[model samples]
Structures are given as C-alpha cells and as structure tokens.
Target: MVSPHSASDNDNENGPGVSLVEIEPGVAVVMGDRPLEALGLPAEFDCEVSPFQLMPPGDIQNLADKISLATGGLNLAAQGVHGVVSARGLVRLAPETMKAMKSGLQPLTSGGKNLGVLVGKGGKIAHQIRWVPATGAAATNVLAALGSAAVTLALQSQLASVSKKLDKNLKETQSIAHTIYGDRWYDLMGLYKNAMRAFREAQDLGVVNQHTFSLVAADLSNLEGKRGSFRDNLRRHVAALNTDQKQQLDYIRENSNQILADVQAVLVAEETWRCFHLLRTAHISCDTTMDPALKEKQLAHMVEQVKREYAQSMDEVSRITLELERMCSLIAILPGKRSISFFGSNNTRNDGEVARMAATLAKTVSEMRNRVHAIPEKPEPKVKALRRNVPDDVLVLLQYLLPEDEPLLALAEATCYGEVFSGSDVYLGITLTQFFVADKDKMSQEGIIDKMYPLADVRYVRFQEQGSPMLEMFTKTDNLSLLFNWWAASGPKLADVRRIRDLFATVMNIPEEEYRDDSLFAEAHQAFAAAKTGMKELPRKSRHSAG
Candidate 1:
C-alpha cells in the first residue's frame, strides 16, 4: 500500500505545493496538492488525486520542456488534480498563497486559442505570450471546400477517361468492319451495335457523367449512321448480285434445254436410220434369187448410207456437247453466294444454294459428256467464214464504235430516254460490242454521244411498256439501268421493240423465242407498275384523308 501525504507537504516555500508526476504512460497524479476528499475524490479512496489520461504525459511534458527552454528558464509545470490538468505556466507561491490555488480557474491561453502555456499567480492565469498566430474558421472552411473540389475533379477525369476508351473501342470496331470481308463484316457490325447499346445503358445508369454521355452519344450516333449506310449499300450490292445470278441461272437453263433437245433430235435421227437400214437389209436378204455377192454389195451400200446419217447426227451432237461444256464452265465460275445476317435476320441467299446449283450443272455436263462419248467420233469440219447478216447502217455504227478485235454480231437502233416522253430526242445504237446513246441532232451535227455501255457488262435486258416501249438493259459492273425507246407515233411499234429486244437477247445468249412467247415478262412489268402505283397512292391517301 502507498503511504499518505505527510502534513509537511504543505510547507513548500521554494516551489508550488502541488507537483504533477506521471503515474503511467499517459496518466498523471497531483502528488502534494490535497487529500483524496479535498479534490472531490471518494473516500473509498485513492491515496492521491489523478487527472484523466486524455493525452500522453510525454507529449505534454515535451510541450512544457520546449516552452521552458524557449522562455529562458521561466519554469513551466503541469498541474493535475481529479482528472484535470492546468495548461498555464507555473506560478510562484508563498506557503500561504499555495493554499489559495484553484484548479477550476480557466487557463488564460487554452490549447484551442494559443500554442503557448499561460502563466498564473494565486488562483488566476495571466495573458498568454510567445505563441503562434491562430487561424480563422473561414480559412479552414475554404481549405475543406478546395479538398472536396479536387476529389470531384479527379472522379470526373476518371469518367472522361472511361468515355474516351469507349469511343476508341467503337472506332476500332468500325475500322475492323471496313477491313473485313464476307460474313465477318456483319460480326463486327453486331459488336459495334452492342457496344453502342452498352454505352447508352451506362449513361442511363449514371455510370457516365452528362458531359461524357453527350459526347459519346454523338459519336455513337454518327458511327451508327455510317453503319446503317454501309449495311444499305451492302444489301443493294447483294440484291444486284442476286439479280445477276438469276439471269445466269435462266441462261443456263435455256442452254441446257436446247442441248437436251439437240441430243434427242440426234438420237431420233439415229433410230430412224437404224430402222430404215434394218428394213432394207431384211428386204434384200429375203430375195432368194439374188446373187450372194450382189446382195452383199447392196447391204454394204445401205450400211454406208446409214453410216453417213449417223455421222451427221454425231457431228451435231458433238457441237451441242461443246456448247454445253462452255455453258457449264461459265456456270461453275460464277460468283458464290454471299450471305449477311443482321441481328439474326438474313436477307440474302447462302453459299449452299449456289453450290447446289453448280453441282446440278456439273452433273448435267457429265451426262452430256457420257452421251457424246457413246456417239462415234467424227473429224472436225474446216473453219467457215462467219456471215455478217447485220444491217448495213448498224454495221457501220458498230464498226465505228467497237474496238478492232471485237466482232460485231448484231445491232439495232431505238429511241432513248422514253421516260421523259418529251423535249430532247435521243437514239440508242445497240450492238453486240456496246450500246451507244446519242442525241439525234448532235450525231447529225456535232457528232456528240451521251454515253456508251459495254455489252460485256450487260446482265439482262427486258422490254418495258412505258409511254413508249422501252428496252431496259441492266448492267452488272455499274449497277445501272439503261433504257432505249423505239421511235413510233402509235406508242412504240411492237415490231421495233421486238427487233431491238431480239438483237439484245441474241448478244446476251438469251433465247429470243422464250421472251416472245412467255407472258410472264409482261406480267412482271405490270406487277412492278402496280407496286409503284400502290406506293404513290398510299401517300396521296394519307395526305387527303380525314383521319
């Protein structure tokens, strides 16, 4: 147990009666101030009164030591009584004055107001001296606001950085789409669409700030517009290709039919000759009175006749087979079908259909080859001069327009630009080599032509019934339609239209007879006209309707 303070503790003269001593690391006791009861301590009782350990004693002592040293031995001491410590500098006291010390007196300079300790005499603390200047509350508030602004700025910068990254990704996706071919372009388009959707979602969710969202949204809109344009262009190209394929398919089918017909004709001729020879042989063999050598000679003559007929048939078959081979080769090399799907919707034929068609063509070619092999071989005929049966004026125009190497097979003249039905008159110079559109006055005067389209680029030609009969030539390379109108007072004479159409069909390897006989071509034109009428009528209805 600790001993109690002695009565002589109050007899200090050189120093204050009270002195603070550290009881632990942070706790301190006022050793000689008073008994436990005097400092309002319970009698259950502590031997001495202690201050609360709010701060470490070493920290307070260090502050005190620094002040004493700075003030040149103006000795400062901490006083602790009943869990409270005085912040004032030490006070000098006589024996009687020590009893008047009051722990409740507020220090003249508290730590909140000043840096230095306050010096006191008796129960009162004097004014503080030798301390740092105090900062105003407004200055502190401004510093806090500045710190918050800095943090907000950092968050915004991060958001902007994220938005920039998204923009870069979108651009990269678009660039990739431009570089990719085939179906991969569609894949990249899908990715770009998804990315735009994600960006919009993020903006809606407040993951991106308004400024960043606006900038990115604008970029997305522009990119999406470009993407839409690209898709539209691609769809148009695919549709054009589909039309070309259809034309090629029709040409192949027509050629196949012709070849098959020729083959059947040759077979029929062979069978006819075989029956004739057999009957003649039977007739000769049945004559019992004829000499054996004479009968044999007659039979040999009959056999030679049959051989000649068979040889002719074989020659025709061989020519048809060669033509079939050429057609099949062209079919085999035609462009493969390309398919593009947007968001799981496909509007074009896949490659498999093209492959199947090619396979069927190949099988037909093989069948023709087998039939040709079954026929006896014949020596090829000598080359014959190709007769130029074309019109003299048309021939002259073709000769003038075409290159030297290209042979002019057929030509026709027709009025062009019949759609306008008025004003400037133009004539089209149609040949196997190229189609020339020239103004009649210009050709007769200055010799100026509007345009020349090569027949090689022409995919299909159809007769369109406009105000006048128009020959619509669909070209592959430029994806354009060329219309040639025939000049006739009575709404374009069918004879003139048929003449030009026949020439075009002959040049394009399409059978003219099919176009002449089939009503489907006329029906298709009517359907197209009806669709156009319907489209125009819809808008008119909407404009005038009460609803």
Candidate 2:
C-alpha cells in the first residue's frame, strides 16, 4: 500500500487536478477534470469526461506514473488521490505512440458508455478494451438489427440470380416446344408447364419482381397458344397424308396380287404345253414302227403347233406383265408417299420401301416381257396391212411415248380423239419422237400411210371452244401453228375432247397458270367499261329463236 504525500514534496504547493485511486490490487481508476488527457491521450481524442466519474481502471502503478509525468512530478495523494505505485512503471508516450493508442481506443469510445481497459504484468495493455453496453437488451437489439440487414441484402442477391435463371429456362422451354411435334409435343408442353409453375411459385415467394412476372406470364401464355395451334395443324396434315398414302398402298397391293396370279397362270400353262410337246417329239423321233418320212412330218407338225401355242401363251404373259408395270409406275408418282410409315409398322411402310417393292415388281414384269419377245417367230408372207387392219402399230407408238424407266400406260379409246382431214378421218396417236395420225376407219387399196410430227418441236398447245371445239399446236423450231377444227356432227365427243386436253397438259408439263383460260378477261373488261359509263347492256337474240 502507498500513503498520501504532501504537495510540498513536489514543486507546486497546490496539488495536481488529476489523481489515481486503487480500485483493486493491481488496478486503479483515474479521476479528475481531464482524466483522459492526464492519461496521455491526445487533445484531438473526443470522449465524455466528468470530474467525479472514474475513467476505465488500469494498472495502479502505471496510472500513478502517467499522472505524475503529465502533472510534472506532483504527488497524487497530495491531490487527494491514493494508489500503490511501482518503481518500474512507464512514464510518457511519444506523439506517434499516442496516436496508435487513440486509434485502438476509438471503437471502444464510440461504441457505448461502459468501457474497460485491462493491463498485464509490466504495465502492458492486455487484449483490447471492449466497449460494452450497460444492459444486455441493448446489445441484443444491436446485433439483431445488423443480422437483419445482412440477411435482407443476401436474399435480394439470391432472388436476382434466380430470376435470371428462370428467364433463361423459360426461353429455352419455348424454343424446344416449337421444334417438337405429335405426342412428343405433349411431353415438351408438360415440361413447360412445370417450369411455369416454378416461376409462379417464385413470384409468390417475392423472389421475382411483379412487373417481370407479368411480362413472363404473358410470354408463356402466347407460347402455349402457338404450340396448341401448331399441334392442331400438324395433326390435320398428318391425318390427310396418312389417308392418301393408305389408299395408294391398297391400290398397289391389290393390282400387284392380281398381276402376280395372272402371270403365274400363264407361266404354268406354257410350261405344261412345253413338256407335252417335248414328250411328243421324242416319241415320234424314236418310234421304229412308223415310216421315217411320216415320222418326220409328224414331228414337224408337232413342232409348229408347239411354237404357235407357246407364242400365244407368251403374248398373254407379256400383256399382263406390261399392265402390272404400268400400275407400279403410276403408284411411284403419287404424292404424300413419304410420311406413311409412321402410321404403324404393322401395315404401313415408308416411301422408299414402297418404291422398292414397285421397282421389284416392275423388274419381274420386264423380265417376263423380255422372255415373251425372245421366242423365235417364222416370217409371214408380205402383205399391205391397212391402218385400220393393223392397230398394233398404234400400241407400239403409245409404248414408245412413255419414259424409258416407266411402263407404257395406255389411254382409253374414249380418251383418244379423231380429226377429219379433207374427206378422211385420222385418229391421233402418241410416240416417243412424234405424234402419228392414222385413219383407223379407212383402209386404202395401196396401203395406209400415217402422218407424223416431231414432239420436241411442239411449243404451245391450246384447247378452246369459241363457237366450236378446236385443238391448236404451235412448233417452236418450225414456227408453225396447226389448228384442228371440230364439227359437232362428226368430231370427238365432249368427254374425249376434255381428256385429250388434260393428257396434253400433263405430257407437256404445263403449269396451272398457263393452262387457265383467260379469254373471258377481255369480255369482262368490256362489261366493266360499259358499267362505268352507265350504259344499258343489250341482250342478243338466241340463234335458234331469232327466226
């Protein structure tokens, strides 16, 4: 313990204004008008100080020595202060050291009213001085406020990130929905709905802004509507395509079966006839009981009969096969044949598969036709075959007109038109290189000569009926136009004329725009001009009733 000393022991008779009081064995509190300043704090350090109030407790000897140095060696007890002092205590602080200490204490002083500074042995500052509030409630409230602010900021950041992710997901879902179709579309739609649900939930949770939510909702609705419309349209298109494909497939299958059966029958008949002829020839050639010349004659007769029979059988087979090939070629040209496979694997096939089957059947038909043509035939006596008597040339011409890869498809006789030239009528026929006009009704005594025209030279073909039916053809190279007039009394029927026009359009590959009749345009224009002039149209009397 240290005793109070008189002021006379120091320089001033009046003691120093600041003093130190020992609060515990090693701790003392500084009390004075300016205790912080006496403790070596800078003048710039701002803190509340009261004369009676004690400063934070610190090492007793350190506090005494600091007060003595600040007051110029005045006794602390002479100023009415009492504290135990140690000889090894620190005295003064440099300006830089005081600044560092001020900075260290600034947080404590700014925090609360209650603050404490702890010191260890040799008068060194122990950890840091902590400013604690007088009450636990105030401290708890401060901490809670700080935590709330931090949490709010973090939540906002997370929400912003989530919003961005949701926006990207919505766009991706919409793009995928547009690309997929059929039942696959439904699956994608379900996923889109799920994404929308998540977005709505996020909006409810306040993670998405109201304005952004509204915009996204509108976009999603539009996307869904477009997807629904697309699905409906696609379904209708698929249904129509499936119907057409099924019809064509059925037709091909039925005709192919019929042709196959007919060819089989012809083949069987030919084979049986061939076997019988071979047996008969062998027996006649080997028979020793018969005369050699008689045997030779019999064998020759049998061979001739066999040849004739075989030729007839082959001709029948060739005809049936050609018809089958023609049907297959027609099937190949039909539209909407590609998408038929998805209907079901059980009864439906892709266009490639169907085309392959048609090609195979056509190949078989061609081989059979070749076999028919390969048989040797004896030359007949030369005679003038009239155009009316030999219609086979017309058939040959029709065959030649078709594409090499496609079989010849015959035109019905009703679809062929006859034109009367001079006093003779010649029916038109088609060939690969030219059109042949032959007199099917008239046979000349000298012979029949058919008129021909090159097809490639023909440029424009038009069928029109102004007063009577007419067919016109213009040649590009020759620059020649040929017009055929039809008299109602002897011309082709109306149906035949229509068919002839349509066939010509198909063969010429005429566009729909070119084939359309625009002759009425001039008359309509005249009527419009008359109407604009406010003129009354006059009705012409009918030819039959005018008399």
Candidate 3:
C-alpha cells in the first residue's frame, strides 16, 4: 500500500512537485502511498508498525488499526490503503480500510493490463487508492530492516533448539563420563562430543586445581627467554616431579587427545594441531633412559609443567595436613599397628638397639651451608625445656642424629640407665623431628640423599610388619620439617582418646583390623617366618619317609 510515489507527483496540474507524505511528526497515511517508510526513522518503530506481520498473525483487527495509524489515517478505510497484505500475496488495496473497503476490495485479472488496484476501483465510490514507488536509498533501507527483523526471529528459534539439544547431550555425556573414567572421563569425553566445544574445559568434570597455570607458564616463557641462569632453578622443579606427577600428566593427555580430535574436524590446520600433538607426545616420552644432556634440556622445558603440578600437591597437603595428623595421632595411641608391611626392615627397636639403618649419603659442596647437620635445630635449647608428656623430647630427637657419630647413643643410654622402657613418647617425637631435618637437608642438596647407616649392619632394608609403607615411614618421621618455625614445646600433643579414634579411622581407610607395633620381636619373628617360608628341607628325610 505504501510506496515512495506521491498522489500529486503526476498531477502537477498547477503547482510544483510535492511530497505526498511528509517526514515530520508521526507518519500520516492518506488515500496516497509515499510515506510507509521514511528517512531517519528509528529502528525500534519500523516493520513493527503492526505486531501481526512481525509476530504470529492472530489479530486481524489490530493489524488493521496499526496500518491505519502508520499511514496517519483517522478512518478505517485509509488504514487498509497504507498497508499491503502479505499473508497471501502483495496485494495493494483501494483507498479504504479493511473494515470500510471490505465490500469493494477485488482481485486482479490476468488480462495483462495490470487490473489489480483498478479492479477494486470504479466500482465502490467510497474512496480511491493508488500504488506508489520509493526511490534512492530509502527503499533499500526499508527492505534491510524487514529482513533483519525476520532473521532475528528465525535465529532465536534456531538457538533455542540448539540449546535444548546441547543440554540433553551434556547430561548423557556427564553420566557416562563419570561411569567410564571416574573423575577424568568427562573431560576426555568432552573432546569427542563435538559438535566441538570451543574450549576443552567446557566438557570437563576433571579437577582443575585453582592454580593459575597461565602465570607459571608465563614465568617459564620468560625463564626460557633468559636461557642463561635457568639451569639450577630448572633442576629444582624437575627433581620435584615423581612417578605420581607423571600419572596425573597422562590423565591430562587423555583429555587433550579428545580436544585434538574435536579440533581436527573444523580447524584449517588439522596438520598444525597434529604437529603440536607430536610435540606433546615427545614431551611425555621423556624418561630416566634419556641422554643426560637431553634429559636436562627436557627437564628445563618440563619445569614449567612440573612447577604448576607440584604447587597443586602442596596445596592439597596444606588442605588435609590437619586432618591427616589428627587421624594419625589417633592411630598412634591404638594398642596395635593397624597396617602391615612384609618388606625388608624392622620398624621398632631400642634406641641403642638400632643395629642398622639403610640411609644413603651424598658427598656435595653444600651449596647453601657448611657441613649440613642431620637435625637442623640446636639440641641444647630442647634439652633445657621440659615437656609435659614427652620430657627431654629434644634429647630424644637428637638421638635420631649422630651429634658427632654416637652422641644420640650416649644420650639414649643416659636417659634410661640401659633399662630402656617402652613408655617414652620423647623418642617418637624426636624421630619425627629428625626426619623433618634430614628431608630438608636432602632437598637442599638438590635431592642428593645420603644413605646414613645407623644400623648399617642390619639384616633388612625396608620395614616389615607395617602394612602400608606410607604409614610405616610416617610413624617414624613425618614431614614436620616443612612447617615454618615448628616445635613441640609450643603446645600439648594429641589426646590419647582422640588418637585412638583416629587410629580406627585410618584402619577403616586401609580396611585392616588389628595393629602391629613393629617391635623388634615382630621383626625377628618375620625374619624367622621369611626364612622358614623361603627354606626347603633336605631330600634325605623325605625320601626315607616315602619309602
């Protein structure tokens, strides 16, 4: 109904050319067709002239009213003239409203003379309507506006469908992911779910330690750029990684492969991703057998990743340290050692009876200090301070170290007059403290461990009877050295009741029931058992019996 053409442009009967519909105020609709779309009209008010065309067409009457208003028509007849009906075809109306011109609105015949608008005309005498044309950029802008509106609705619907499908798939994937890979499956499975995710993390159910690897990686990038003074620090991080770190890294690789598959489907350089994959696989290939020089080079590169990973473990230890100590302390008071070990060494013996120790020694030029002591703290302060439950605990702790070579031996003997009783807590406390210092010394030496032989002549290397190696070593010496300014004199030790409760809890975790003290008696018993278990009787007695 609306076109750029004016009613009087052809009728210049007496005046200059004039616009049929002016651009000011709200657009006005007349028995003319030039103002349907105007210049500089705000985007908000366009094609939205009626919700019927923009939305679902349920209200015909409402559409008619909007059209009338859009064309500035006061009556209903002029409303229909200002609009074109698109439900069927683009039909121009006579100069009347759908309500008023309902009777005269007619169809066009195919006589080839264009009898469309004229068909409805010359019959009803109410009013006259004419087709109009718009020229210049105005027409283009209007069409674009309409197109944009239509596309918006279409895109909205399409997006809704996509969202529903994604949610369904996500749930199914997550459940299967958990069932399949435990904590790691979703992340790896996420890679294969593409319809690819833009980032691998989108599908991850795997634990992401809140460590900002970006910062650490950035540090590595800078460190590599220096390439001059990075060797020593690089070695420190490299030595930090153990077999456990490698296992975690392998799990991450599993997820990355899924990402690689997802990226290959659409990325331009599938080859580039593949090359990058090869590079990563090469990184994982590094092992103990690599050439020393090559190992060092890879270690430098690996430092970045290793640092990032180790920081996570340190964080984990910090989180559970309190809980772990509480649990371990509980077990310490239990009547028996809950866990067992069938290995080499015996855990418990008299202080002087520690006949052998499988300690390793490293001859190094103490980069940090001169003659690194077995125990970091001075024994003098501890000997002077008396503890409530663990009296002379410091002296007992010093006994784990050879103050000069046999100072701990003399101290142990002096404390008990050679009648060494088993009720002393001081020795246990000292043992853990000595372990802390020794571990620190080991680290400071860049993992150059010293195999100190206290009972160097002992029969076994590993402690037997303690079921769990972790617990066995832990009872003798915990990682208390890691704590800053740590000392037992500062507070009371764990209560006996709590200690017992915690021991039971640990047993539950290990699924073990009775406990073993790992005493000398037990070790001797195990040695005999092992000897008996491993020995075969001679054939003479057996042959006689058989005969």
Model 1: weakest 10-residue lDDT segment is 378-387
- Per-residue lDDT tens digits for candidate 2, residues 164-240, read 43344335333323332345444444434444454444434433334323433434444444444533443332233
lDDT per residue for candidate 3 within 1-547, as digits (tens), equals: 2212124322322221111121111222122222333211122121112111212234223333333344333222222434432211011112222223234534231111111121112342222233212222332333233322222222222222223333443453333224433533343333333212211221131211223112122233332322222223222323332333223223222222222122211111211122122223223232335685665455345434433443343233222222222222222222333331111123222211111110100101110011221322324432211223332433333333322333221111111011122221222212211212223222222222122322212121221212211112222111111111122213332122223223322322211333456689989999998888656554666778999
> Model 2: C-alpha RMSD to truth?
47.8
Candidate 2 similarity to native, TM-score: 0.25
Q: Which stretches of candidate 2 lie over 4 Å from their true place?
A: 1-253, 338-547
Each candidate: what lDDT?
0.37, 0.37, 0.26
TM-score of 1: 0.19
For candidate 3, which ten residues in a row score worst on lDDT? 358-367
Q: Rank the candidates by TM-score, best first.
A: 2, 1, 3
- Give the backbone clash total of model 2: 0
Residues 114-153 of candidate 1: C-alpha lDDT, one tens digit per residue: 2222234342322222221113442233223222221222
Q: Residue 360 of candidate 3: its Cα lDDT?
A: 9
Between prediction 2 and prediction 3, the one with superior TM-score is 2
Error of 2 at 153 (Å): 99
